[model samples]
Target: MIELNPLVELIIMNFAVGLIVTISLNIEVGYLRIPQFGRLLAVIVGAVIAAAVPGRILALYLGLPYGAEYADHMYNAKIVIQINNFLSKNLLLSLAVFILTLVLAALAGGVIGYLCAYPALRLKGSYLGITLLTFGEIVTSIAWNYQPLVGGTAGVYMVNPFAFVGSGSSSLAALITLTIAISIYIYAEILARSPFVRMLKAIRDSEVASEVYGKNIVKARAQTLVIGGAIAAVAGALWATYTGRMNVASYTRLTWTFWPWAFMMLGGVGNNLGILVGVLLFTLARTAIIQYKYVITSVIPIAAEWLEYILVGLVIIFVVMFKPQGLMPEKPTLTLPRKAIEEIRKRVEQEQGRL
Candidate 1:
């Protein structure tokens, strides 16, 4: 059997993560028309939870103290070692803990998202975007400076849930991440086909019109935010667990916010199929650049680190200039039943004849 290269595995892992982040953004910006510029907020919340929650749970499960004692690096390291040793001997317990962490992380994210909706109710467009962006920056700064949050700049090491898989842990993680990504894509596709999606599009197109038709625009937006935020948080949690570390620095605006937005735009904002294509294209290009930075720099006479940004900017510019709607523009959704649509069409023709 041919063994998979670690670099290939890492690329696949990143692509899966990108898919999750972009799809969540699609729900907020594409379907609901909520320009959530601070998409990092929900993602960081997940990472923070992953950093703190699972360790505390493990401490309690192992009959250890869960508070300040666990916060100490020395003490925490000892406990982590013990837990690893125990998990190494018991695969079932390790898997259970991993699954439980994901569930708790998702719930925590949902709660934060629900609270965020209150502010969203009063804000719109750029104002809403700026407000959320500021909030994300503030929280990230706190996480960075505050030692209690993921050990500040130093960060905290996390136990690998798939350690039970031994030497194949990286491959297992890649497989799991891809599975979850596919599941999220399917769910988003289903949402796109639903009447609720039509309602979202209606609200996106014109809040006044939706409200005039008796739709609660604020409520709808809140609900959409809650759902999208929860999903984004899950992506963050997965990243934290997969990497076996939690650090505020890892959840930067560039990684959690800007890139996902870029993917959404390049892929054609609301189109799921476009999202997949866009993610693959951008991710492959990014990985290739990173892998061949020396050759690129020698050829281009520019810093390799800056080239990725330049490429992203160029793609965005070209897409906007030539295909403003995206490579695959948003298509009109048919929500009403076929018979109902036919009846409405016939009525419209009769009214036109009388006119």
Candidate 2:
């Protein structure tokens, strides 16, 4: 068996995570035309749940600390080590625990998105976006201060359910993540072709007209956010699992929200395959810049740490100026096949002639 290159693995892993989140964003912003500026909220909530929940459950199962003591970094590290040891020997239990963790995280994220629907129904445009952004910031602050929720600023270690794979654990984890991402991409494609999405598009293109046609505009938007949040949370859970740690500070708006938006815009809004392409290209660029920042900075006399941000800003400008429709623009969708529509039209005309 050929070993995967570490650099390639890193890019693939990041691209997978990016694809998951970007697709979620595309569903909201591109398909539903929702101003979901708080995309990071679901991700952070999911990561926190993934980081804190499963370990506590395992601790309870093993007669260990699952409460306040478990939140302490010292206790967290020790307990997680014990959990990993146990998981390394029990493949069935490990798999069960991993699935449970993701389910719980997705639920938490979905709940948050559902709650945001209240505000979403009332606000529109930039106001809604700002409100969403504020919600994310508030959650970050709470997570940072609430020690019981993943050890506050110190963060908490996660139980590695893939520990049973031993030396190939990380590789297996990356493969699993990528697999999930691809599965989500398939789901998104199916959703895009569904009648529900067509309804959403009608509302997106014109809320008043959609309402005039008996569509519940508010309900569709709410549904979009809930679905988007759940999907984004899956990405966050995967990240937490891959890193085996959850730091509240790590989930920033710029990283989780804005970057995904950029990816969606660059790829072509509402285009799922385009999201894959955009995510792969951008993830490669980001990883390469991070890897060779020192070399670039040495030659250019710029701050290495700021290079990625500079690249994002430049890319956004370029996309807006020259490629507003993106690399793969959104294609028109039809409710019926042309042949079916023609048949219906002929039937209607024949009925009219008989009348």
Candidate 3:
């Protein structure tokens, strides 16, 4: 087996997770124009579900302690080792556990999205954005203080389905995550070219006009949120699985929400390909700074920790001032068949020539 450089592995994992989350954000805020500031809500929902749910199911199957006891640090550590041993030997079971966790996470995330739609329907513009942001912060507070959900501040071990791969588990996990992220990117591209996305773009431009055209604005917004939420949750689940732990505190507004928005904005709002470009550039920049922060700080006057924030802020400001539309600005999707549009264009040109 070819060994991956540790740095390369880390970058790949970050890119995959960032891509998934940013694409989710693009679907809502970009195509649907849903000011989805509370993106972290569904992500936390996914991570919490991945953290708390799967192990219990496995415990029931194996006749081990679960629920409250499973949340205990000592019990969690001991039991997870046992589970990992079992999973490492039985590849099928490990795969099952992995799939089951993501499925549950996606479902719960979708439900949460549906619930958020109430506030979405009631509020608009910055008010709606603030409401969503508050919702995320509220969820974070609950998860941070609630022990049973994910062992609270202490955190909890996640069932590593990839443990079956032994020492190569990290590489396998990164590969799986990157594959899933790419799959979602392709799906998002197809979705962008779909009539549904066109409708979303219309509603985004003018809800009143969309409503006049018989689009159910409420239903559309709700559906968009549900889809975005489920996708984001999958990203969260993947992160939990990759790290083999559920640290609710790590799933913060800065990493999960704001970063994705910045990525989507920098990449180009409403452009999936542009999102890929943005995520790649931002992920590399962020990762490099983190990896060499101490080294860089030793030579510079700035604090190592704050360098990321300062650099990102400066970069965003530059982009906004010069490339306000993003590195790849949104382009109009073809609403008509290419051949038909060409024929019409030819007729119009001929008529103009006669005139």
Model 1, range 1-355, lDDT digits (tens) per residue?
2335988988888999999989999998999877788889989888888778877788788898677666556676777777667776778887887777777777877777787788788887889889888888998999888876567777777767777656777688787888999999999999999888889999988889999999988788878888888889889888888887787887888889888988888989999989988898899999999999999999989878899999998988888788877777888875689899999999999999999
Alpha-carbon shift of residue 179 in model 1 (angstroms) = 0.3
TM-score attained by model 3: 0.93
Q: Cα deviation in Å at residue 76, candidate 1?
A: 3.2
Model 1, 45: alpha-carbon shift in Å? 0.8
- Model 2 — which ten-residue stretch has the worst lDDT? 1-10
Q: Give the Å error, residue 307, model 2.
A: 1.9
* Clashing residue pairs found in predicted model 1: none
Q: Which parts of model 3 have CA positions greater than 4 angstroms off?
A: 336-355
TM-score list, all predictions: 0.91, 0.93, 0.93
TM-score rank order: 2, 3, 1
Residue 193, candidate 3: C-alpha displacement in angstroms: 0.6
Q: Rate the local accuracy (lDDT) of all candidates.
A: 0.84, 0.90, 0.90
User: In candidate 3, what are the lDDT values of residues 110-169, reduced to their tens digit?
Assistant: 998899889989988999999999999999999999887788988899888988667888
lDDT of 2 by residue, 1-355 (tens): 2346778778878999999999999999988777889999999988988988899989999999999899898788999999899999999999999899889988888898899899988988999999999999999999999998789989999889999978778778888899999999999999999999989988888889989999987788778888999999989999989987888888999999999988988899899988889998899889888899889988999877688898888888999999987889999895688899999999999999999
Clash count (model 2, backbone only): 0
